[model samples]
Target: MRVFIGYVSLSGNTEKMAVNIKNRMMAVGCEVYMERLDTVEVDTLKDFDLSFIGLYTWDQEELPYEANEFYEELVQADPQGVKVALFGAGDWSQPRPCGAIDIVSNKMKSCGFAVYDRVLKIDQEAPAPDRIRQCEDFADRALSWGSKRKKWRFFIWNRMQNNPKYQRTAYLLRRALDDYPIK
Candidate 1:
């Protein structure tokens, strides 16, 4: 499956987590596209079968500046039907640790992305063995979701292609499906 990972990291904590997520997904035979949140276009979300968003919590439980912008753009980008998973890095000792992950996950849900509840939160800037395992588990679940969605899409496409009236719609859907083929 095709996956996209967009993340923001001020001190590389979130970046490290993002890399771990990428590696895990790649290990599962997924085609992953990793990009910094500041550089990624929100509209590109539609091109992937699954998405992982990672960020660090800023002051007052707010999203980091770049991630805040990315959130706004995501809300306006029509992300309906996209599959999403969230992760964040922060000091648990802080009053509001990993708050950005909650914020992004909720917003993505509100925008119609099929967001899962298994969010990964890392304490401090270091990765533990448990955290790495969590990342792998997260990848496995995301891959499973993508696989199911692909099957459903194929079912719908097959049905539509059988009806002459929906041939045009089926063709366009086929193109979109081509961009994110299931493995």
Candidate 2:
């Protein structure tokens, strides 16, 4: 699988999680590409089979400046069947812990991308063994979802292109089926 990981980090917490995710994905024989969100080109998203986004929640549940900028660019682009998985690091005590994950996930869904259901959120300034394991698990789930999505890609894209009603219907169905209790 070809995977793209774009992230923004303040104080290195999110960056650490991004790196761990990159390493874990690479270990599993994926062709992985990693870059800061500020430096990534939104148009290149279509080239990847799977994409991972990492971000830190800013004050009051907002995405950091760079992530917000990327989100704006992302909103204007067609999803083109790229599946996205979100991960982040934040303090659990914060008023909105890892809120950026929700922001990005919602935006990706709105843009008609197949978003992975399980998001990886770490409550630490640095990764612990448990958190590292969580990253690996998240990568595994993402790969699994990507593989399954391949079988339906042509059908979904065809419906999305030829029928406007099917676009929303397909998204809603996928969202319902992918929804699961997060551990």
Candidates in order, TM-scores: namely 0.77, 0.78
Off by over 4 Å in 1: 125-127, 149-183
Please give the distance, in angstroms, between residue 140's alpha carbon in candidate 1 and its true position after superposition.
1.3
lDDT of 2 by residue, 1-183 (tens): 778999999788888888888999887667899999998777777899889989988887888899767788877887888888999988899887888889889988888888898898889654478778888888888877886554445534554646787777766765776765111
Which pairs, if any, clash in model 2? none
Clashes of 1: 0
Clashes of each: 0, 0
Kindly list the per-residue Cα lDDT of model 1 for residues 1-183, writing each as its tens digit.
678999999888788888888999776556889999899888888898888888999887988998767887876787766878888788888887898889888888888888977888889745568678877887777667666765655655666788899999878877888977644
